[model samples]
Target: YKSIIKTIKDTPLEEFYTSGHRTCQGCESALVMRFLAKAAGQRTIVIGATGCMYVANTTYYSTSWIVPWVHTQLGGSGAAALGTAAALRALMRKGKIKQEPINVIAFCGDLGCADMGLSGVSNAMTYDYNLLIVLYDNESSANTDIQETSMTPYGAQTSFSRPGKQRRIMKKRWKKSVVPMIIAGHRNIRYAATMTPAYPLDSINKIKKALAIGGPTFIHSLDPCPKGWDYDPRFSHELGVLAAETGLWPLYEYTDGEIAYNEPTKSIVEGRMKRKPVKEYLEKQGRFSHFTEEDIEHIQRMVDEMYEEWEIPGVMPIKSL
Candidate 1:
């Protein structure tokens, strides 16, 4: 692990997604795209869905992407990427193109992934397309004025979940676990993992691994949105770390029917590191500012239940026993 980290750190800086993009300050999705592009290298084709990424990176005629990129519909990027991969395979088989292997990557936001594009993504996984699907989950429909997405946490205020004087009704639904949904639906998926930019090394490693695996790879990255979540822009990384440490977003990898909990998650499972309070995570963002003491306790219970559902004996347990 040290060697791998050293190599990644020592690697010469190469930017596939260059500067001059129109992303806001402390944009986690932008950071995730940059990291993924760096790991994927230049011999890659990116299919971006209609969301913050598409609007920010490709304004009118100008684009920040240096490699081949295509814009797909909000709910069509997954299928589009699969089609691109199939075309490439056909071309290679016909000896029409003699260049090195090119990777097809689909980039989508939480709205596109869990809500609008769920069927497309599930179908792509079912077909076992040789491509990478990256879901940059910011937990809300950020580009659409911070509307509540399917991945939005409960007790969070959004455009769709406005607080009322009579009864403040935040999001009532819990964030959907797309990872388990994919795993349960597609048995042939070569690789899947949850990552965050807070751990750059881990994120890079997972991207590299997914690219190497070559068949229906999925990576769910927690993207902290300062605008949507209403947090200090500079605290993006801090928020990510807090989310992981508090078990609000536990990092783990699933491959070949085996799951491996990573870092603080593993430590928490083994009783080496105590799971931090979920309130520490929720209180930091304005989205959850409306959460009461009872709401906090309910969220804490939900997190505990989530951990238990994802537990794997000797790898990740229900609690620090």
Candidate 2:
């Protein structure tokens, strides 16, 4: 660890992502962007898609990124990155852009990644493009005022699927299982699902691993949006950590050839056995503000089922909802 620290200290953090932007107070996405760029170092190109991050970090006449950056249409970031990588690779072969190796990283939100950018990402992975796609999933489309996305949990209300007497169900549809979906597409690619604030060290490590790989890599991060999650700005990290501990979200990585679970605290099983309830975390967010006792129980049940089905080593099997 001491040698690792010394090596990191020797590397410069600046000259990559410079400060000065107007991102939201509790948005974990910005912090994630900073860490990833830092890990990738100075010779990198970032492809930004339409989302809260794009609006805040690259408003007209101002930009936060210090590296070579390009913004593309929301649905085309993956493709754009693919194009950029192709052009860069071709240029290097022809001695056009200094022939120096460069890293290409794409950034997108939940809606953009799981919903809009799915096909392009799938195609890029299938082609084995040299790029890293970071899905900054804050659950809801926080930048657009919290509309429901496929990643939104059951009993969690968004404007699109708000609970009411007539339609009193939080997303009745299951959250889209994107990790497996991506895995099915490109077995050669490295894939991992992570959460910000809760597992920053693990998160950083995963980013480092993905960068080391030669082909396309996916790192999905569950960033908490305090404004959308309906919590205090400072509680963003706490909420993110609680979600993983409650079995609603698990800290795991898929790479090499199998899946590896990263449960640093053994909190999911232990916490479920002795803690007050999952309601404590749900009650903190306005997304689940309308959930009744029965609704909360339903959510817990789903979490339990997922836990059992996923079979994460060292974690207890979840009971059915």
lDDT (C-alpha, whole model) for all candidates:
0.86, 0.75
TM-scores of all models? 0.94, 0.88
lDDT of 2 by residue, 70-179 (tens): 98888787898789889988898898779776889998888888898889888778666688888888878877888988888776777788777887784887777676
Tens digits of lDDT, candidate 1, 1-321 = 222344556644999998989988999899898988888888999999999999999998899999999999999977898899999988988989985679999999999988999899988887755899999999888997998888988878888898777666567887888777787678999789999999887888888888888798999999999999999999999999998899888888898888888887888777788789999998999988877899999989877776655455322324444
Give each prediction's root-mean-square deviation over alpha carbons: 2.7, 3.6
Where's the lowest-lDDT run of ten residues in candidate 2?
1-10
Which is the leading candidate under TM-score?
A: 1
Ten residues in a row with the worst lDDT in model 1? 312-321
Error of 2 at 265 (Å): 7.2
Deviation from native of the Cα of residue 194 in model 1, angstroms? 0.2
